[model samples]
Target: MKTITFNQKETSPIALEFDELIPDEIFTWEKSDFDSYMVPIGNSKFPLSNYFDVEVEGTAESPAEVVMIINGDLGRVKYIGAKMSNGQIVANSSVDLHCGAEMSGGSLLVNGDAESYAGREMTGGELTIKGNVKEFCGASYIGDWRGMTGGIITIEGNAGKQLGECLTGGEIRVKGNCDILAGIHMTKGLIQIDGDVTRWPGGQMQNGDIVINGKLSRSLEGFDYQEVITDPTISGKSFSGKYIKYLGDIARNGKGNLWLNAEKNRYLL
Candidate 1:
C-alpha cells in the first residue's frame, strides 16, 4: 500500500484545488513528484510545495492500495478528493467547497465541517462528515439535471438546505438536524434523517423515499397523509417504532414516499 500525507505549510486567501491530487491520479507518484507539482488556485497555478509539505511512503500498483491523509486546516482547499475512483482519503480539518465532487469510487472522511457541494454528482463510494455540512450535500451541480447516481453520505452533524437536490440514486443519512427541502426533485434514492427537519423534505420528488426519525416543523400541502406503519424497512434499512407514511408532491404529479416518526410528529395526526 501507498500512503501520501500532506501537511499544510501555509494558507492561501484563494482556495487551492486538490482534484488532481487524488489517489487515482497520484498512486504511483513519488515524493519528488509532489515536491514539484503545482496546484490550482483561482485562475492561476502555484507550486503545491509552497502551500504543503508532502511525504510519500510505500508503493502501490493500484489506486485501491493507496491512502491519502491531509493534516491541519484545509478550509481553503477545494475539491479535496474530487473524481477519485479508489483509495481512501482523510481530512483532519474543515474543508472548502466541492470536497468530493463527481467521485466514482473510494472513501472520504472529513473530520471537520465542510462547505457547500460536498459530494455533488458522485456515482459511487462513501463520504462521511463528522461535522456540519453547509448545503447541497449530495446533489447535482448547479443547472444540472442529474445528481448523485450512487454511493452513500453520512452526516454526523446538521445539514443545510437542498440536501439531496435532484438526486437520481444512492443514499444520504443525516444524524443531526436538517434544513429545508432535503430531497427536492429526487427521482430515485433514499434519504434517512435521524433529527428534526425544518420543512418540505420531499417536495417535487418524482420517485424515492425519505425517512425522518425526528419531528418535522412543517408539512407541505402537496403531500397526502397515508396510514401509519410499524417497524418499517426502507431501502434495506430497518427501523423500529411506528412511522406515518405519506405520498405526494402531487403538485408535480410526483409519487415519492415520505415517512415521518409518528411519535415525534403528533401534530400531523
Candidate 2:
C-alpha cells in the first residue's frame, strides 16, 4: 500500500482543516506536489509545507490503493479525511471536526479521540476511535433528517451528547458512557451503548433501535413502557438480560422502540 505521512511542525490553536489530504486524493501526488499543496486554515488556505513536512512513498493506481498516516496533536486540525471513497487513513492523535464525514468506503482509524461529526453522513466504511469522542459523533447536519446512511463507528471510550442523532442507517457501538439525547429523531439504524447514559435517548425516533446495556438516568414521558422481557430479540441479536421496551417519540407519531436493560436501571422502576 502507498503511504503518506503528515507530521506537524507547529500547533495551531485556531484549528486547520485537513480534508484535502485523504488517500482518495493525493494518491498519485509526489513530494513536490504536496509541497505545493495549500490546506484550508480557518477561513483561508495556506501552504501545507509551512506546517508539516511531506513524504510520499510507493504508488497507488487508484484511490483505494493508498493509505495516509497523520501523527501529532490534531486537536486543532479539523476535517482530517472527509468524503473519502476508498483507501485507508490512520491518525496517531486526536482529530478535530468532520474527521470522516461522508466516507463511502475503505477504513479510517484514529488512535486517540476525535471531535464532533466523526462519521457524519457516511455511506460506507469503518471509523474506529480508540478514545472518547465529543457530541454529534455520527449525526446528521443541522436541519437534515438522514444521518449515517451506512458504515460502522466503534468508540472505545465515552461519547458526548447526541451520539447518533437523526440516524438513518449504519451502526454505532459505544463502549463507555454517553451524554443526553442519543439517537434522537432516528428514522432507522442501530445504536448500542454498553455504558451509562445521561437522559432522553431515542427522543422522537420514528424507527431504529437503541440497546442500552447500562443504567439510564431518566425516561421520557412520551414513551409507553412495555412488559419486562428476558433475553429479548433485538435487531436479529439476543441480549442476555432483562430489557424494558418503550415505544415513543409520540410527539412525532413515531413507533420506534427504546430498549433499556432492566437489571441495570432500577431507578426507572
Candidate 3:
C-alpha cells in the first residue's frame, strides 16, 4: 500500500479536527498538497503543517490502495477517520473523540485508547482498538435513533457505558471488561463481551444478542429467566460454557436475548 505519514511536531491547545484528512480524500495527494492544506480547529482553520510534518511515498490510484499513519500523540485530534469509505488508518497513540465515526468501508487500527463516539453510526468496515475506549463506542449519535448499521468493532481492552446503544446492525466484541447498559435499546446485531460486565446489559433492547462470557455483577429485573443451555451457539458463534439465557427488557416490551456465563453468574440462577 502507498503510505502517507504524519509526524507530530506540536499540539494545539484547541483540538484539531481530522475529518478532511482521511485516506478517501487524500490518497492521491502529494506532500505539497498536504503542506498547503488546512485543518479546522475550534472555529478557525490553520495549515495542518503547523502541527505535523507530512511525508508521502509511493503512489495510489484509489483510496483502497493507500495507508495513512499518524505517529506520535494525537490526543487532541478528533474524527481521525470519520466518513471514510476505503483504505486503512493506523494511529500509534491515544486519539480524541469520533476516531472512526460514520465510516462505511476500510479498516482502522488504533494502537492506543480512543475517546467517546468511536465508530458512531458506522455502516461498514472494521475498527480495532488495542486499549480502552470511553463511552458511546459503536453507538448512535445523540438524538439519532439508529446506530452502527453495519461493520465490526473489536476492542482489546475495556469499554465504557452504552457500548452499542440503539444499534441496528453489526458486531461488537469487547475482549476485556465493559461498563453498564451495553446493547441497550438495540434492535439488531451481536455484542460479545469476553470479560466482566458491570450491570444492566441489553436493557430495553428490542431485538439482538448479547453474550457475556465473564462475571456479571448484577442482572436487571427487566429480563425474564430462560432455561440454561450447554455450549450455546449465539449469532453463529459457538461458546463452550454453559450459559444462562434470558429474554426481554420487559419494561419496554423488548425481546432481546441476554446470555451470561452460567458458572460466573450462578447468583442469578
Question: Any runs in candidate 1 off by more than 4 Å, and if so which?
Answer: none
Q: How far is candidate 2 from the true structure (C-alpha RMSD, Å)?
A: 1.5
List model 3 lDDT by residue over 101-206, tens digit each.
9999999999999999999999999999999999999999979989999999999999999999999999999999999999988999999999999999998899
| Model 3 ranges off by over 4 Å | none
TM-score-better candidate, 1 vs 2: 1
- Which ranking of candidates, highest lDDT first? 3, 1, 2
Model 3 pairs in collision: none
Better of 1 and 3 by TM-score: 1
Clashes of 1: 0
Best by TM-score: 1
Q: Report the Cα lDDT for residue 63, model 2.
A: 84
lDDT of 3 at 6: 96
**Candidate 1: tens digits of C-alpha lDDT, residues 1-269:** 99999999999999999999999999999988999898999999999999999998899999999999999889999998899999999999999999989989999999999999999999999999999999998998988988888999999999999999999999999999999999999999999999999998998998899999999999789988889999998888889999999998898888899999999998877
lDDT of 3 at 178: 96
Q: Candidates' lDDT values, in order?
A: 0.94, 0.88, 0.94
**Candidate 2 residue runs with Cα over 4 Å from true position:** 267-269
Model 2 lDDT on a 0 to 1 scale: 0.88
